[model samples]
Target: MHNEPLAYRMRPRTIDEVVGQKDVIGPSTALYKMIKSGHVPSMLLYGDPGIGKTSIAHAIAGTSNLPFIALNATTSGKKDVESVVTEARMTGKVLLFLDEIHRFNKLQQDALLPHVESGSIVLIGATTENPFHDVNPAIRSRCGEIKQLKRLTQDDIIELLEKALSDEKRGLGREKIRITKEQVARIAEGTNGDARKALTMLESIVIASDEEDGEYLVDDAIIEQMIKRVGVFGDKRGSHFFNLLSALQKSVRGSDVNAAMYYLAHLLENGDLTAVTRRLLVMAYEDIGLANPAVGGHVLAACQSADRLGLPEARIPLAQAVAEMCLSEKSNSAYRAIDAATAAINKGQVGDIPAHLRDTHYAGSAELGHGGYKYPHDTPIGSFGGWADQDYLPKELKKAEFYKPVVAGEEKKFAGIYEKLKDFRKK
Candidate 1:
């Protein structure tokens, strides 16, 4: 254990030592109460990487006083689960901490279900991917509340670092190392709320620093050098990615340019140009719609240019599109209208087309009452836009009003024309 990496060695051995994730493991939380009672339920923990999912599991194992065994879904299979189950039978109950549980295939998850159900194995699964979207339902249904561990706050990271720095057994306390509060704070913020990353970086800086008279001093220069080497874990295939997209769209819809740009930056940072472009195009039509009809075309052109350019260059066009959308006259009249029409159809509100609107090109159409279609172009009315007022909708839905236009941008003019047409139809 002394030879292990600082992050691994510093993992909390008891619930009292676990940091952050107050939402799930806080003293007043149901999970905390359960652990204290010594009867732990099978649960799944999910969040971003390095956010104490495994640490929480370790804490649970320590408090539960049950046999603890570990397996990773990526490498462990049905046989590995069976091995655990076999041990569980001998021990009467084993706390099985399955890491990366999202990668467990359906068959593998199903095999573990019965043992979990029988309480022989108190399962605690940890995943970076969202269990709601990635985990098998059989396993999901059997687990208790799917706990979401959040990124540790800067203070939480600082507390963990302080604890590790003072612990002689698992941490680097005995060594005559010197680090300032600001330097430690830099590590906390630079790690992006990852406690493991903070601890590992501190360990690296201490080991790599030059020793003078057996005392290692860490400064801003060394800290910045190490911080620059840390990679931001951009999760393009997880729930965080989708959440960012949703946030971007909603911000644009609310006409908040700054908020929209903020989310766009996150997506760009993640390197998902396709998602950014595609979502922007959808927002143009879905939110801007007839209010600023030209925006749809502009967004499409921008998206096309973005797809061709890709990356760093793509961000320019994407940013321009997002900004334009935020400033545009917002309206969802067309979007809501189409959705309302679709809902009616979905509920069996559809009706047969009137004979005048039915296809008449077929030879037998004349015999089936498919004729009498008035030509609006030729049989024009006086000044009602050179139109013949006729029921285009099916007879059963002739009075159904789906396209309720809004008074916004170009749609405002369209709404006036719509009212005139309705009056004309009455005659």
Candidate 2:
């Protein structure tokens, strides 16, 4: 235990000490109430690493006074599980904290189902992967709501670091460390809300520093030397990456250029040029359609250029495109119109084609009453503009209006033409 990592030694022994994730383990939360009531439900906790999945398990054991045993699924097989089961039987009930539970194969997972259902082993399974996608349904069904732990906030990490510095038993309090709040905050920021990384980095810094007078001094130079680069949250395949994409789009849609650029930088840092480009092109059409039609062309050009240039150099054009999108007149008229038309078809609104619009050039068309089609180009002058009175839609939907053009940007011209056509059709 003395040789254990500072992060391990500083694990929260009670639920109250568990920092962040108030939504899951707050005083009034269901999980908190359940635990306080001495009812420890079998559960699965899924989230990014260093977000207190194991600490929560330890806290559960502390609070409920249950015998706790931890086993990593990657290395432990059926025999290890059987030993835990034997311990549980002898002890009446045991809290088994299984890390990387997703790595358990079918047979290995099957071994836990019976014990979990019987309540002999109060299971607290933890995984970095989304449990729904990775955990077996049998195990999932036996577990209660799978609580998703969130990455600790900057404040949470700071609080944890302060606690570690002051804790003599599990921390560096006896070292008489001298560090500023700002320096601590810098460390917190660099860890990207990962408490384990923050604690590990803090421990490393303390170990490398020399005592000045009676206190071990930490300076900006030391910090910079220790933390080479700040960790960026979200990988290409993680849900966080998609969340960043969503944030980028919403910021652009909301016309907050500053926020948009911030998320864009996050994506660029993640090194997903393809995904960001695809999303930008999509945004141009879906969110800015018809309002500023030329914006789409500009964005397409920018995407092509960015793809050709490739990142570092690519962000220049991409930044321009993002700014253009953020400042452009916003409208979803074309997007809504198409979706409305699609919904009409989905609801069985389609009717037989009008006779005048049916095929008439195939041959023997006059006998079938398909000969009344009038070409708009052939209309006489004064009624020009290639306009002609025609029933293009089937009789059932001759009056159905789907394309309600917004009168803004270049779409105002389209709205004017639409009104004129509607009047002609009425006449």
Top candidate by lDDT: 2
lDDT (10s digit) by residue, model 1, range 1-427: 2578999999998887889887788898888998898869999999888999899889889987888898999998789988887898898999999998888887676677898988888888998887988888888888977988889999999999998889998898888888888888999999999888999999999988878899997877889999988866648957888888999999999999999988899888888888788889899999999989999999999999999998888889888999999999978888898898999899988888888888888799989988887787786655654677677887777778888887989899888888887887786
Worst 10 residues of 1 by lDDT: 380-389
| Predicted candidate 2 versus true structure: per-residue lDDT over 150-269, tens digit per residue | 899999999999999998888887777889999999998888888888999898887777777877888788788767755576678676688789999999999999999999999999
List ranges where model 2 is wrong by over 4 Å: 71-91, 100-109, 127-140, 210-215, 225-228, 359-371, 380-384
Tell me how candidate 2 scores on lDDT: 0.89
Error (Å) of candidate 1 at residue 292 is 0.8
Per-model TM-score on C-alpha atoms: 0.93, 0.88
Candidate 1 root-mean-square deviation in Å: 2.2
Scored against the true structure, residue 50 in model 2 reaches a CA lDDT of 83
Cα deviation in Å at residue 415, candidate 2? Answer: 1.6
